[model samples]
Target: MAAPFLYSAWVAASMVLVPFAALTETRKLRRAGVSVARAHEKLGHATEPRPSAGPLVWFHAASVGESLSVLALIGRMGQALPQAHFLITSGTATSARLVASRLPPRTVHQFAPFDAPGPLNRFLNHWRPDAAIFVESEIWPQMLRRTHARGAKMALLNARLSARSIAGWQKRPKLARYLFEVFDLILTQNDQMAEAMVAMHAPPDRVARGINLKSMSDPLPVDEDALFEARAALSHRPVWIASSTHEGEEQTVLAAHHRLLKTHPDLHLILAPRHPERGDAVMRLIDTAGLSATRRTRGEHPGAQVYLADTMGELGTWYALGDIVFLGGSLRPIGGHNPFEVAQSGAIALSGPHVTNFDETYDAMVEAGAARIVKDSQDLAATVDSLLNDTDARDTARAAARSFTESQTDQLDTIAERLIKALELAP
Candidate 1:
């Protein structure tokens, strides 16, 4: 009854493929093509305590957004399973840094082993986790094969897959089935994601309990000194935040800022690009737009400073500094970023129609009238201007944002219970 070919094909594919990549990518560790997992081994989880006896659970998240969500989940899960140990792996330097600061006392932070067979084999042999939980859409062939082979139960939490992604996976049935078979459970974020998983042939019992729990991430800790410095320098300019912006979104923001300057000359724009590496490129974009911008790295807060929030793990503090918060990546084709923290920070939350990444959060906010959606460039500028200029409108939106942000009640506990059940742990 067991599917042996599926397992063999996945492992063989990884064994043949990953070595060529490891050799090439090891040369370029920090750049665009470099593997984040490789760089993390150099940075050290060398200090992490070796896993001891009962029910070692390993959770893997790909990048900043996914990692933060799982970090919160790990904390909740740890409280319920005091006897269990946890291995938390995230695939970005930013994510690793965030995990180091925020992970629970029982959790260990490491880079997830690459999808290649040899490394994955070594990883599983060493850590030997009894259960694995993957956040988001990580479906690496060898990692799943090795975990399943070693008799570790796997689950996907707060998971999502786009329609386009589903169609692509459907084309590769062998690979898709291999990935699907690995996860004992596939807990999705929304109905749309659930439907997509079914289309990709995820087994009936393996997928269920689809709900968007990512809206409940613990707010990133505020850097009090930096926030105080920024507040002191800005001298009461009506400020709007543009959080987690992608490429085209910045242009839209700059255009909107140009228009807003006509009505409120002292209005400041705070831009936080999605990628930290793109921070300098965004500063150049600001320069080219003829807007005075100041990078967060500079200690002196120059006059006419549209603060470029380039630092990591301070999104909460940045949101608090704003009179209006425009959740970026939505105004453009980029799938949008987490705006839940913006609402939590009590900033009047503004987003656009392209919020597929955080659709469940968007739905909750829109239904609660906690957030507003802008249709285009003009709409974005108008909404932000209205929020900034009208205290009543801003207060209404801020209250709604906070209300909806607070609505996600104990999702982590629910997820942890299901994960334990899937692992067949003693109740």
Candidate 2:
């Protein structure tokens, strides 16, 4: 099929705007202290040379969560295809830093090129990826079309779409089909998403239900020294973490912590906000809630009523300190953050009612007695108290959580094999 008119128009507009986009994005990255050469990657200027002999498999994800989710898959694929070189691309410097620490064997990381002819051409020509795998919701039409044009097999893995996105695509059915048809396979997060893809005109045979890649994400790396120091500072104080809390959710977390403090006066709440930049605002909230707090960025010990874990990349240590955890972002319809980390840390997860992002995972967890749903401050407080007091119940929940996370790992090899065959990545 010929390219849709909308897609062609988009390409034309992008040709004019790409230079400005590259300049602006590179400038932002540079100001964030990225090296000039690395920042220019936004323009498809790769810092590393592509390997000369091996088949190159490219994985592209949007940011930190998406980027990290694919590492285990890459590891599995690398084991299967020992000679294949892997390239993983994303747009954020933060993701680059994190991924650098956990990159799979024979894998290289780069900032993805802007989806314009000049950058994409430069990128495609240099790498010449044999196969391209795009992660959840990263459907840049130009990128897909250009990659397909290059004769590379492509797969859309861990695909997810909001209802609003489906409605928008439904309006441009031809363009939707045109883009969806580029992928050799489309593995969705759930059956509903598979149906959504089909409704948007993706070939029915190409779309299939797949596990949530985020649920299968590699366990967060823990800092042993930090964990030990934190444990000593807390000195057996009852602890529960309210992790990845957002703006509206913190007030409720604080209220619940306040109620818990009345009974378990020595209870410690490590409040790790989703964005570390929100530390100051969260500190003010802690003050208003009449809770004594200490900031992690300030290097304070976790002795206060609330330990403000408002720094990036330290959630693993926090998760280790608590047996009971209330994952935030579910309370106010923000969808929930990953519960996999909580389960991996061997903690019982308590989440609010709205966890659409991880709905399938959360549902299975609740049904298996691995997680509980709390509605508000009162509910959250009661659940935490019960878990803290009841060792048998807490242990059982933790066991269930471990069991669930372990079971998910068994599917990784199967998924990896499927992708290997679908994208023709195997030797």
Candidate 3:
């Protein structure tokens, strides 16, 4: 009964939202630098024909991080179910590029359609996926309902429900229950999130505590030639990296670097902005600080005190050049970026207190002594100084991080088997 009302309400809301969403997409395409010509893909228009053979499993992620988190699982599942072909969809242009560059064989990438009746139906008709899997907190009512109507087995993987969102949903319990009930299974990131799912009326049996999948993801890919050049140019300088930094955080990072420079004059800082499109703005910021900086986009070596690695898809290369890494996005209330990538790069991870976005993973890593937290520039500089000065502590943290990462491997196997079994049982 609630399902009918919820569906009707969603239909009405989507009808009203379609035009606004289209305008928003145009703005995002402009800012994010995706092609305007390919913008039709977001309206449920297919750029490539659906594969003619094999059962298709559709995975939808909202952006780069979510897409990367599930990538290994998809590969493992594809290997186990060789007859299955994977269709991965994301809404962001950046994510689409990463998917195209790194996607495995028997898999394809597409931009997801907007959540309106026309677009959702067109996407469903063309792809006809046997199973639909959505990552994290992306809940689209039209997409969920339309996919369910088409008889696709739906699963929510590595799901997270923030406290604020939970509070909002509690006020609309029937609507929440109706929407969550659409998922055949709900694999949550932690016990807190699992409890939230049950509280919101997702069947307790259907919802299970799952490990954070980012801990098991492969390291971001690197370009070998660039890596070699960067390493050779450094010539064993005392180095640290501030990776995936947002707007306000870079100022703090520069201040921290300035302090560190007073003691070690040749200390090199690799500053990687979260969005490479902010490269020009970052250059101006460095100039304002009177720091000598070189942009990686220009294919320059690190001859200055600071290296502005403002390029895409080369985090692995930068990670290899430094041992002390400050994971960004945490310092500026942007939640936090993943730290496991730094761990995989064999660096000691340092982060700020605002890691609620990756709460479970960060907490586990901290408890295991694999990561350290910083409150401000002074704290960050001190932590980096301590780690770089003590080889034993640094190596121990590095080893603990890799061990923590290794301990989570079996969870993916369990998850893959369960998903494959569920897909097999689906009509």
- Best-fitting candidate, measured by TM-score? 2
Residues 1-427, candidate 1, lDDT per residue (tens digit)? 2545755765667667666665544454566443555554533323355667668888888877787787677777777787888888866566767778887868887766667656676677678888888888887666776788899888888778767788898887766776787788898887667777878988877788656656778876887987887788887877888888887788888889988998999988888787767888888888888898877776546347477878677777777777588888887767777777777787767888888888777877878777888977798888877777788877877888777766665565677778777877544
CA deviation > 4 Å runs, candidate 3: 2-6, 23-27, 30-37, 425-427
Query: Global lDDT of each model?
Result: 0.75, 0.92, 0.86
lDDT of 2: 0.92
Better of 2 and 3 by TM-score: 2
Query: Candidate 1: where are CA atoms >4 Å away?
Result: 1-10, 30-47, 171-178, 302-305
Model 3 score (lDDT): 0.86
Ordered by lDDT, highest first, the candidates read: 2, 3, 1
Residue 40 CA error for candidate 2 (Å)?
Answer: 0.8
RMSD of each: 3.0, 1.0, 2.0
Give me candidate 3's TM-score against the actual structure. Answer: 0.94
- Cα displacement (angstroms), candidate 2, residue 347, comes to 0.5
Q: Clashing pairs in model 3?
A: none
Please write out the lDDT profile of model 3 over residues 1-427, one tens digit for every residue.
3465766877989888888898899688767777775677777877777878778999999999988888899888977877788989998888888878889778888888998988888789899998999999888888887898899998999898678888887777777877787788898888889999898878777898877777778777888988888778888888899999999989999989998998889999999999998999989989888899988889788869899999888888888888889989998778898988888887878999999878888888889888899999999989988887889998899899888778877878898888887666322
